[model samples]
Target: MAIIRPARPSDAEELSTVEHAAYANYVDHAGVRPEPMTEDFSPLIGDERVWVAEHEGAVMGLLVLTTRPDHLLLDSIAVSPDAQGMGIGRRLLEFVEEHARAHGLGEVRLYTDEAMTSNIDYYLRRGFVETRRAVDQGRRRVFFTKHLG
Candidate 1:
């Protein structure tokens, strides 16, 4: 099983490396580097919002969440290429919803580059609904929201 916890400053370097590797395969598909790939995790790790997923001492994925007045924002999620098939991504998302509800939030929201087709399908299958589309940071984005009761 993978363990998920708040990120520590020391985990920043490996988190950044894991993020880069996770998004490397999507550059060609997006025609540009995805935002997460270039993010500096060192600073983000200090924010209480960053979470890490690991197995046997090796970081395998990360979740960056931002809290809003009405909902939790799923800023970014990445699972290293080598760890993709083991369900870490799904588990991290599950953690997001659970975290949101525990904090008295009603929903979770996220946006992804529209070119990431598999991501679109995956989110839909996971119970998120498409709320809108827009271009952000020069990339076309599909936004999604999941309402929790």
Candidate 2:
């Protein structure tokens, strides 16, 4: 079974490891490092904006969320490469939605690299609708939003 919990400052190194392992594939395809790969999660952890999915005391996946005025931003979701097929990503996403609902947020929003068609399809299948596409930080991104009401 997997346990989802808030991240701590001590988890910084492990979360960074997981983030890198999970997003390494995108570096080659995007011709640059994915945004998540370049982030310093230590501060986020301290702010309680991060969560981890652990199984048997091992970190399997993680989600980073930012609370906004009207909605929560699903900043990043990453499952360790070794744990990819175990439903960790789906569970983490569900957790994010529940967290949003609990916080009285009306919606959740996320963006993915335009090149990651599989990820875009996954979000759409989960009821997220495409809101727009734009170039941000030199990368073409596809944005999606899911209304919680």
lDDT of each: 0.92, 0.92
> What's model 1's lDDT at 120?
96
lDDT by residue for model 2 (1-149), tens: 68999988888899999999998998888788889998798889888899999988888999999999899999999999999888888899899999999999989999999988889999999999999999988889999999986
Candidate 2 stretches with Cα past 4 Å from truth are none
Give me the runs in candidate 1 sitting further than 4 Å from their true place. Answer: none
Itemize residue pairs with steric clashes in candidate 1. none
Instruction: Write down the TM-score of every candidate.
Output: 0.97, 0.97
| RMSD for each of the candidates | 0.8, 0.9
